[model samples]
Target: MNIKELPFEHVTVKALDIFNGYEISFVIENQTFHFLIGKSEELLPLNIKHYFKNQEHCNICQKMIFPTPFGQQPCLPLQKDMKDLLSHLRKTYVVLT
Candidate 1:
């Protein structure tokens, strides 16, 4: 299915009092993916599709977050959401051409 067909949404944009510009959230499939955006054109993926039930370790934030992979791309909106993520990331950060 196409990305537009997926149930995607920009949940919120919070300052979060961090050095970065803001913490943006995109909700897809009941999962909240976070991104750190700077004042300029800087962006980093805090976590994507995190699985909190397991309470695993996250490499990015050094927190107990498990970034689960969107397996079986064709069956669901996994691939579409991943692709849409880049577009939002670009809006928050500089997409190096």
Candidate 2:
């Protein structure tokens, strides 16, 4: 299914903590979209809930950097939209999972 086809207002993103940087996790009902952003480990809690609140100015970029055997190549531009969402934030490895 296309991310664009999904209800935009129903789409929600969350922040998860990783070793080197932060990971932004998004969900559309049961469907999940995960992206990793490079950032200093010092940024605790990552406060993704707040970041997504103002995702309009976001420009975070993502790639198929991770090995996802079970993952299908998403044609949905949600990743790009997400990149745009994190545009103002620090640069990081945005990997869609």
Candidate 3:
């Protein structure tokens, strides 16, 4: 399925497995949808307007750091709508929960 065609307004990372890939859940008009993104597909460059912050937690330093993108990060600037959606998701699902 094309990620761009997804009708979700908000999305959260439910789970991430190295073997199984990403388990993403999203909400659209109060309805929630769940889908799995394969490992190979997960690394693909997404055709979305979003800044690719390839930041990961540093175990030793305990700080968020941007990693070198080895063809694994999306490189684009986020549009207003995408930013709004991300903000909503962060506020409702990530920060709150």
Candidate 4:
């Protein structure tokens, strides 16, 4: 499903620790959905926006330097971090119509 199709009205993000991880929460149709991200040891100089930007590439460096099973791909840490959250929401929280 397209993320744009989700009924999200607003989003809130909070830093987790000095390691530069974050917790992202979404407000969808008045209900709250949340997810946590751990620090990336591979990516140096972590930034908060990395957890929020909506793009296939890293918003900070604008480079496709991150490694993945697919090969060195565009940095999509936010997308990767949301994987479990999206699945959990799809299975238990989000009400599809």
Best by TM-score: 1
- Per-residue CA lDDT of model 4 for 1-97, tens digit only, reads 3554556555655676665665556654443334545556532222122222222443323554323333223234434445644445446544322
- Would you estimate the TM-scores of all the predictions? 0.41, 0.35, 0.31, 0.39
* Every candidate's lDDT: 0.46, 0.38, 0.40, 0.44
lDDT tens digits, residue span 10-84, model 2: 333345454555565554433344445555634432223222322122222233322233333442345445544
Q: What is the Cα-based TM-score of model 1?
A: 0.41
Mind giving the per-residue lDDT tens digits that candidate 1 earns over 10-79?
A: 6566775757566555555554555544555644433334433344443323455444453201212332
Q: Pick out the ten consecutive residues of candidate 3 with the lowest summed lDDT.
A: 43-52
Span of 10 residues, lowest total lDDT, candidate 4: 43-52
- Candidate 3 per-residue lDDT over residues 2-97, each given as its tens digit: 224435556667546555454445554443333334446333212231122455543222344454443222222222234444444455555322
List ranges where model 3 is wrong by over 4 Å: 1-7, 41-97
When 2 and 4 are scored with lDDT, the better candidate is 4
Model 1 RMSD in Å is 9.4
Q: On TM-score, who's better, 1 or 4?
A: 1
Residue pairs of candidate 1 with colliding backbone atoms: none
Local error of candidate 4 at 93, Å?
A: 21
